[model samples]
Target: MELVDLTTTPAEALPLTAFKAHLRLGSGFADDSLQDDLLAGYLRATLAAIEARTGKVLFERVLQWRLSRWAEAGHQPLPVAPVTAITSVALRNAEGGVSEVAVALYGLERDTHRPRLFAKGATLPAITHDGEAVVSMTAGFGPSWDDIPADLQQAVLLLAAHYYEHRSETNGAVRAMPFGVVSLLESYRNIRVLGARS
Candidate 1:
């Protein structure tokens, strides 16, 4: 996979827990009442976006499917969308050192520049090249919809879907950037993406 540092982030990345999980999963805070599942449900409806982007299964099964209007219609069960995901994979011994693959993806309601975040689970690492500035960069694939295995794809997609739901609801009060998905693909040799809409 060809990795590119779209834009570098700070080395001091936040913890995965700090990012939102699919709200439909209950916010990990309470059982139900307190939180709303709408945010997560909305993201779940757009699972196809996964294949369209990386051509992989970024989610698991319908268990995590969002409770939405479309969902009420009843089709064949679908996977969830991503809220946050990784975009880098690590190579243990390569080129006299370690190598990483970076990824980036985004979705839009229309023609606006909005990257719909996806990956619900991901660990963003602090990257810095031997340049002048010590910028934390990430790299991976492109606006994919590529191909990955089944089980692994499910895991990635599920996480993305979950995160999308949670993040959407929490960030509703304030307009936040599309969530980000960063992952180590190709058995940790390639970096892949599936983040909240960018």
Candidate 2:
């Protein structure tokens, strides 16, 4: 992850005060709801159910919040056209191995899918040992994850934007992002809002 200027964001990107309180409030909403192994099984089952119903992974919708801020700072408005989100990044190890990493955005909504890489619905599939995302093609999602700093978060958005712009529907699978993905990662605006608040 590269460094982005911390001078152009709002006073609070995430409302930690509210978030903590919310977590406390919701802590016991599902007590004993999931046993460890049962929870793991449930996670798998949930992913399967989601894919069977939607044709895409749950992760695509999850990554919208992170990218939206970057979009707001720049000319782009997080939800461009009909694009939903970054989903997760597909990665390739130096050895040529492949895997998928689910991008975690902010809160997710039901009944609607975010426009993102795996929006078409997919099984959780195989994640690499490092938890990088796996795309059908040889896209190197690992590089994005390997060096992901808050700054590089924008690269993910830019890269996704580029993907949507150049997407070809002829194929059933998503394609790799262009090399300029590096440049896209560099677009995070500087934010002085943090210091001002302090």
Candidate 3:
């Protein structure tokens, strides 16, 4: 199965000013405007890194996930957390024709950490063509950065600050995260299983 992001959060929705304040930059500094842009870049990078690390979308975004088949015959776990809704599901034929799956056939098994697509009946629809079943949905904690939990918000700021502080470093011994950041994100990280779910 492959998960593709259909749309990402806009730049304006990121906590740019918050990050600047966290960095202790004065609001009226000469480089303040430039700093805002720089902070945006860092925040974007850090937000992606955090989402990649945690499997939790901090802000709402549309995602398209492709799958060869359903898991456990009746349900398939979503790759990200806090799924707000499943927009649609489609099956593509061998001739490249796509057909939509009815909304009444399936629904979301909602959870902040591991949402899943649960078939309403005994079985899920069969895809005639391989690698063509696609599930489109929106997933995240909230619609904006302010909707994110305080700990995650802090984690983003700290990690962005770390990235900013070491922007010029070329050392090969860089750690993935500082102790504090790691501690802050530990509870949010997704623990992937080595094999298929039982």
TM-score per candidate: 0.21, 0.19, 0.92
lDDT of 1 by residue, 1-198 (tens): 121234422222211222234223434455543333443333333333433444333322111111212111111112212212332234333223554434332111111112222222242232234211111221122223232344334444454555554553764532322333224233422233697322
Candidate 3: which stretches are off by over 4 Å?
129-131, 173-175, 192-198
For residues 59-101, what per-residue lDDT tens digits would candidate 3 score against the true structure?
9999999888777779888888889999999998778888999
- Displacement of residue 171 (Cα, Å) in model 2 is 40
lDDT of 2 by residue, 13-122 (tens): 32223223422434455653333333333233433332333333322222222221222211222221122323334555546675445444221222222322322233
Sorted by TM-score, highest first, which candidate order results? 3, 1, 2
| CA lDDT, every model vs. true structure | 0.30, 0.32, 0.86
Backbone clashes in each candidate structure, one number apiece?
A: 57, 31, 0
Among these predictions, the greatest TM-score belongs to 3
Candidate 1: misplaced stretches above 4 Å? 1-36, 59-198
Task: Tell how far residue 150 is off in model 3, in angstroms.
Answer: 0.4
